[model samples]
Target: MSHDIDFAQSAIRTIKSERDAIDKLIPRIDGTFTQACQIMLNCKGRVVVVGMGKSGHIGNKIAATLASTGTPAFFVHPGEASHGDMGMITADDVVLALSNSGNTAELVMLIPLLKRLGTPLISMTGNENSALAQAADVNLDTYVEKEACPLDLAPTSSTTVSLVLGDALAIALLEAKGFTPEDFAFSHPGGSLGRKLLLKVTDIMHTGQQLPIVSLSTPLKEALIVISQKGLGMTAIADSQSQLLGVFTDGDLRRVLDQELNLHTTPISQVMTTQCKTVNADMLAAEALNIMEDHKITNLVVVNQQNKIEGVIHLHDIIKAGVV
Candidate 1:
């Protein structure tokens, strides 16, 4: 089949036009946007995001973004609200309604009830004079010059503007609330981000007898045995008091071989790296990864406040745990 170059060119032109529209829309995020943010931030309860059709889809994403970014929010379809879902809204909550036309009948029907409940309403709309916008406590203008669609009928550019506006609102609230990576991690406990931000050395490190360890006076052969059995490629060398003294790795074995030292007879401590990097068990796994990258090393010993070896973490363990 022959490719339609015209279709591709038309699509590219549409995208460029939409991008230009969005660029112009950025300047409109001024006092009114700030006011909307203030209202939502000071709201005593959750944000109820409501819309219809394509706007509803965008509203759902907006609600999720807001919820994950430290704002309490949930999407409530306007059609559902006309039924029993309106009960989900309360006097303490704030409603964020999305509509390009700003006159969606299902949403307009809830304005009176929302006002009766004393809930604040924020509207994202292209039409400022429309009922939804005029009735709202704050109006966020999401007007676009035209839809990316050649016919100017499809939601394209308008929906993109609305989504970007929603992201702006979420990020503003996130910054206002001082929401940190640790807080975001708590809200996203099931993903790789959660592991990186929330999981600490203690959560994944091998402890007790599982830790490959050898006394500083142990023979190189004995240390190699510990490393082999544990399959960690390294052994923590500790003093008689069990304080971490150094680390012996496969790299050290290579150096030992180069020096013609007999692994069977030499003391492991003689070839170990004394200034090995160590981390606290309470440190985030992401932070640990940074240390590893910065030091150009793979294995790290989890140490206590007293600098005694508590556990060990290999780069492989971090990868397995989805921390990096």
Candidate 2:
């Protein structure tokens, strides 16, 4: 037995419907959208998002996106708000309500209370004439021509438009506030992104006695021992004032091996790479990784502005810290 259904065509229709719905939203991102953004931007407490059913689900995600991107926000289920969660909202906050019908009972029921508390209301609804939209300080019209659902009863294209609009609002606010990737990383500190943005060379570099160091007069053979003992595959050659002069790495060792020079008798300065790639201790570890990749080297010597050796940051240390 075979089915007549064209699964790919059905999916394509749904995707196109949602895409077109999002395109319609572009024109709606005008004065009202700007007013909504201004309200959230001026909010001192947080952006409290509330909705019912599918709208509620999208509201949760929108709140999270706002929170992670510099605008502090959180979701409050409208049903729960009627009971006691309403207290979570304050006059300092700005309420962002999501309802395709514009009159979700749960959300609408809280309008009077929201108004009484002097909390600014921003609504995303398909109907501009909705009670929620009328009551809101600003309304974002997320109207959709039709649902992607064949029955046209399910929240399909409308929900997609709401999600896209929510993302647009968050990103616009983020840009207006001058939000940076570093600021975003602070909100997601446990992830790899956090490590990449927050971990500085000083945080991962081998400092103090842990740094493999050798003097200009140290024998090439002795510097090799320091490299091995420190297990960094490299050693920094500094002057008597601890000023960085050069660096000797495992790669350099390979090149030196091809030479007939006596490792035991030759001074490290003669064999070390004088023009070494170095990073400041305060430089982001991710940036250090970029420098290392650009130079095709595995380690970097951390130096101060005065050319004084501070620490050694290895590619391994960056990888271990999840900044790679």
Model 1 pairs whose backbones collide: none
What are the Cα lDDT values of the candidates? Answer: 0.92, 0.93
Q: TM-score for each prediction?
A: 0.87, 0.89
Could you list the CA RMSD of all candidates, in the order they appear?
Answer: 2.9, 2.5
Q: Candidate 1: deviation at residue 41, Å?
A: 1.4
lDDT of 1 by residue, 169-215 (tens): 99999999999988999999988888888898888888998999898
Task: Indicate the residue-level lDDT of 126 in model 1.
Answer: 96
Lowest summed lDDT over 10 consecutive residues: which window, candidate 2?
24-33
User: Clashing residue pairs, candidate 2?
Assistant: none
Off by over 4 Å in 1: 1-5, 23-27, 189-194, 262-265
Whole-model lDDT, candidate 1? 0.92
Candidate number of the best lDDT: 2
Deviating ranges (above 4 Å) for candidate 2: 1-3, 190-193, 239-241
